[model samples]
Target chain A: MFLKILYHLFVFLALFGSLMVVVSKKAIYSALFLILTMLTIASLFVLMNAQLAAALQVIVYAGAIMVLFLFVIMLLNLGKQAPLSRRSRPVRWLGLLFGVGIGAQIIAVIYSGFIPPAETTAAASVTIDHVARLILTDYLYPFEMISVLLLVAVIGAVVLARRHLVQGVETVTETAEKAGK
Target chain B: MEYMIPGNLVVAVMIFAIGAIGIMWRRDAITIFMCIELMFNAANLGFITLAQSLGKPEGVAVFLFVITIAAAEAAVGLALFIKIFDDRENIEAEKLDLLKR
Candidate 1:
């Protein structure tokens, strides 16, 4: 009973943090709110017995992706922009309608019993070792393919950054030579 | 099945919704990317929760795949951000009218 209450508390906090991430004005505060949201979600994963996933949530998302976001925000010095005024009334109404439509669908799914209650069947215990075995055996091909995708991404980033650096150096040289002449 | 709905699922939906709203409304590119990451994390949470509920390891397997994709996204997004900042000295998405008609 205590644990379930704790889980609900965490979920509420997570939801609140996510809302803050959306509503906050400052980019840096929004980023921080996102991190809070991630951590709360990770805790929810832990509650669901997804230990490995919780760790991945922290390591990959909170650790890696968020840091990259922070770096970009800081690097760009994105603080000087005028506050983003609200979009047109029609656009705002459209967004709210869209959200309400989706929420209604989710509620319908829950109420219509389209989704079986979580406790209907006894959950079989799955350990990290079992998860690893499945990954190594059943899902090997997809796993290898994902690595290939990562390799491609690395190459793409390098190519893009290289162009920027090359252009910057060329511009510096051109200006220096012009000054000398 | 300890609860009516899995705790993780609720969290996932909440996080995903937050990210979706941010992506739709935020003007800053970096904030948008962060929102994207939140969306990915939300999906990962859902995957893991469903795996646990179903009594399978497929959830973790999916999480691994997701992690790799997230890494790739971060790499590309960072590179793009750097390039944009270098070119315009600003990263506001609204300012990029070079391609817009």
Candidate 2:
């Protein structure tokens, strides 16, 4: 009973944080709010018997990914832009209307009993040990593929962000020659 | 077989809605990316909820993949954003029409 209340509290906090992420004027605050939301979601994962997921959520999503977001926001110095979109009211309203419409439909589906009830037959929790075994055995191929994807992402990011070394060196030497004359 | 609807599923829907709205509303590229992340988290929440109720570990495994993909995406997307900023001195999505012209 108490745990359910705690879970509900976390859900409320997570929802509020997500809303703030949307509504906050500044990008930095949005990132912070997002981190809060992630943490709450992590706790919700814990409450759902997904302990390994909760740990990864905290360590990777909130810790690493949000840090990357913060670094980008800081690096770009994206602050105090005109909050309002230049898009006319109608176009913007379309987005809001569609979002609400789809959300309502999904909620109705959830309540319409389209989904079957839980089995509750085995009742085995998804612990770290179970996850490890599955990843090593059943999910190994996809796991290897994910690592390759990460490697590709690493190379892609580095190539995209780095400047041409030859051009950089030429610019430095050109400046040096100008200074000497 | 008389189980109540899980409240978390509804919450997941609302979060996804908030994300979609934010993506459309926010102009900043980073904020839009954050909204995308919000949507991903909503999916994660739904997966975990169903996994718990259904007594399956596969959902949690899928959650790990989702997180990994989110991280990889953030890294590459931010780098791309940095490249855009370096070239244009601003990251406004609308202003970049070098191609549209």
Candidate 3:
């Protein structure tokens, strides 16, 4: 009973956090809300008995990816009140209508195909070693490719970020001199 | 647990919906990228949940790949964001009218 209740609670938190992430006006607050969203999703992973995936979700998405976002936002010095251009009323109305139409279609599809739910309980049958074996043997290619991808990304990000540093420095210096005189 | 709790899928769907909306409506490039990540996580959650119900561990393995891809995407994305910001002093996608013609 307690476990079931806990599961529902976590699921509620996950959905609420996701809403917070989307609705927040301040970009930094939105980013922080995403971290909450990721963490709650991690909790959901744990409930589903995906322990390894849960840990990776926190470490990678919440920990690494979000930190990069925060770093860039800070570095760019984005203002909280940055002015945003308003979209035309017709465009906004069209978008809303399209969204509602798609959502209604999805609901209709799901309603038309209902299946009997099976009672599949989480039995602690698989050990860590077993999981490791399946991963290394069956999914080795994907694992290796992902490592290469990360490596390339790291190098690419460095190069791109460096390209701007000189220009940013020049602008700062020019602005400083103007202010001093 | 007899009926599909309906709640299990709700969170994933909500996250995915938010991501789709953000990707469509947001003008900020960085926010769009973050929305993409949110969409990915929503898919990841569904994958793992289905894997667990079916007694499959391979789902977890696939999620690991997702993490890798997400990290790589963020790195390249942030880099591109920096370059764009330097060039235009802004990261709003609508302002980039160079390709409009």
Candidate 4:
């Protein structure tokens, strides 16, 4: 019973955080809410016996990714702008209708009894060691590919950001020239 | 325990739907990107749940790969957003119509 209550609590928090992320006016607030949502989801992973995933979710998502988001939010300095725009009332209503419709469809599918009942014997729990071994053996190629992808991303980010710096310098020079003239 | 799998699945679906709606409704590029992350997280939840139910480590393995890709996506996407902001002075999605004829 306690576990069930805990599960329900995390679920509530996760859903609530996601809603806040969507509706918050400030980008900083949205980023903070996303961290809350990620942490709740990580706890849910723990309840599901995915401890490694739970840890990574906290470390990579709540830690690294969100920090990046916050950095960009600060870098962009969006506070001076008007509040985030809201869709027109009719569009907002249509979006709500679509969201509800998709949700109802999923709930219907869940209740259709199509999902096989859980096996009587609990499945062997996955451990970090087992996942590591599987990655080294069966999934080695994709693992290597992921490393390459990360390398590419690093280079791409550097190039893009550097280009912006150069452009800023050029614009500053142009304005200075105009002032001199 | 019998209801655990389906319950988790329902939560995942709700999260995905919420993310999808947010993506459609929000104007801020960063917010839209965060919404996309939410959708990815929902999918990751479903993957982990199904993997646990089936007693296989493969799903977790895939989850790791997905997480790696998500990191890369965040890096490149934020860089692109910075570039766009440098050009336009704002990150509003509706105002980014450079490609729209």
lDDT of 1 by residue, A48-108 (tens): 7677778888888889878887886776677655244346667656665666566556545
The pairs that clash in candidate 1 are: A118-B1, A119-B1
lDDT of 4: 0.86
DockQ of 2: 0.57
Once fitted onto the true fold, the runs of candidate 3 whose alpha carbons sit more than 4 angstroms away are A81-85, A97-119, A122-127, A164-181, B1-6
What does candidate 4's lDDT look like per residue over A5-95, in tens digits? 9999999999999999998988888899999999999999899888999999999999999999999999999774525456677886788
Interface RMSD of 1: 3.4
Order of models, best DockQ first: 4, 2, 1, 3
* Model 4, runs deviating above 4 Å: A80-89, A163-181
Per-residue lDDT of candidate 2, residues B19-83 (tens digit): 99988887778788999999999999988888778767788889888988998899899998887
In CAPRI terms, where does candidate 1 land? medium
- Which one wins on lDDT? 4
Q: Where's the lowest-lDDT run of ten residues in candidate 1 chain A?
A: A164-173
- Rank the models by lDDT, top first: 4, 2, 1, 3
Ranking by TM-score: 2, 4, 1, 3
Give me the displacement of residue B79 in model 3, in angstroms. Answer: 0.7
For model 2, give the TM-score of chain B: 0.91
TM-score of chain A of each: 0.83, 0.85, 0.74, 0.82
Models 1 onward score TM values of 0.86, 0.90, 0.83, 0.90
Local accuracy of candidate 3 as per-residue lDDT tens digits, A25-75: 666776888898899899877766668778888888899899999998888
Cα deviation of A6, candidate 1, in Å: 1.3
